[model samples]
Target: MSRFTRTQKILMCLIGFFLALGLLFQGMRQASIGDIGYSVLSYLKYGLIDYPLTSIKNFASDFSNLWKVQEENDYLKEQLSMTENYQALYENAQREKRELQELLNMNESLSDFNIISATVIGRDVSYWNDQITLNVGSNDGIQEDMIVVNSQGVVGKVHKVQDSTCIVKLLTCEDKSNKVAVRINFQNEDTGEDAQSEETDSASRAESVEGILESYDADEGAYVVSLLDEQEVEEGMRVVTSGKGGVYPSGLFVGTVKKVESLENQLGQVIYVEPLSNFQYFDYVSVIEVN
Candidate 1:
């Protein structure tokens, strides 16, 4: 046979080299394909598909929990609002209860007197001329000069009256027309005199130490009681109406003696009286109708 050409010989050697190389790597290529195929199939079944399903289930559970939390918050808000309303109502009830109790006590104390209850509606604008207006008026038998009193002591006298309202001049009034006849009450020792006596005699016997409720001392915040006679007056002594002028009834409490001093250009002592009623805060009063 003719000698093979140079190009043909080179092509045959290249093909033989590739054939040997392929045989040497044939086991490795098969093993790699088996492992890669198993890994790709597992990823498609579990990693690609099951991962999204698990995430969806978790999202649904979280959303349900969020709704439950929102509902609980709303319930708490409603309960808090109800609690606030109950607290306000309880406070109002307590205040009303105290006011009612005070009115009951006042009624029991002044049971013997002929009086009509009235509510204070207004107060004077001036501090010097202390005055208060009441709801009761002439229609309710409330007349001018009628004595007004509270549970503690005397409040004032009715100054003006209308069909449905009346104005009262308080004890703190600086006017001379507001003077009240009062007396210091003393414990009378039984002298074995006849107990049964005329009404006029009993009235005279009731007055022990007499004085005039004249003026109010603004500096001392007390009413000035000018004694009609020279008598021993001490601090803490009780003073009441004497009924000498027939305006206020006898035995109506006026005030207590806070201090005593010598009068200027007068014979008797000047007794300073602190009124029993709180003039600044009284709400209710009684208008007296003398029997």
Candidate 2:
């Protein structure tokens, strides 16, 4: 009871050591087996369980990344659309600015010719004689009989002038009262010189003189001559103001003749013409004032 014998103590010590060694060896063996099994699972289940799990995790991350990318793409597209709209507006403004500059240059070139610059403020489309109202008026030294010509050609005459505004009759009015003598510039194919209309010829009221009115410049002698003799004027013929009634200056540019048509008159021929200036598109003009 007080103390064990030396032999007994030695035996107990031996048993304890063996037991500890056995436990350590068993734990090592189990760990080795677990590591071997894990290695096998990685190799065998690569395409099935383990690999599929890894792929699913990667796919989830990719889906999140894709959502962010799509959002960014949509934002970029919206920005591009806005930029395009802005570009179109900028281009339109630039075109208008260029046109205004051209008009200013034309005014400078016509300094020798007395004229007034007028801005169109109103348009009358309903009346038989469509008229355009200008910002200028009698107060601005504008008066009736003043000829108005835009960048294209002759627009009309100042029919009425108020204190602050004036009315301009367009050139196309069909009142049978307004008439301007237009000379066609044709090269006599035989003479090689400019074709001349002899006013001395017998004045005969031919059949209806139907021709598209075109603009002519008196300076260059570009205008529509008569094609009534069934003789179509050659292309590149110039038309000019005849200075017959002094309606427009003799040398101002109207437009070039593109084609001609003819009708038989009882005494002479009637000619049809196509004007070169696109009158319908111009927005500004110059009013010719005779001193």
Worst 10 residues of 1 by lDDT: 188-197
Over 4 Å off in model 1, which ranges?
Answer: 1-103, 125-129, 186-208, 264-267
Q: Write the per-residue lDDT of candidate 1 for residues 218-251, one digit (tens) a residue.
A: 7888899887877778888888988896788877
Q: Write candidate 2's Cα lDDT for 1-291 as tens digits.
A: 649898989999999999999999999999999999998888888867878899999999999999999999999999999999999999878866766677677667667778788888887657423578899998888989898877645657889999999988766554445556655555434322222343322133232222323333233333333432333454455554555556666544445555444445544333333443545555677888865
**Model 2 misplacement above 4 A:** 1-112, 123-129, 188-236
Q: What TM-score would you give candidate 2 relative to the actual structure?
A: 0.55
User: What TM-score would every model get versus the actual structure?
Assistant: 0.61, 0.55
Q: What lDDT would each prediction earn against the true structure?
A: 0.81, 0.65
RMSD of each: 9.8, 9.8
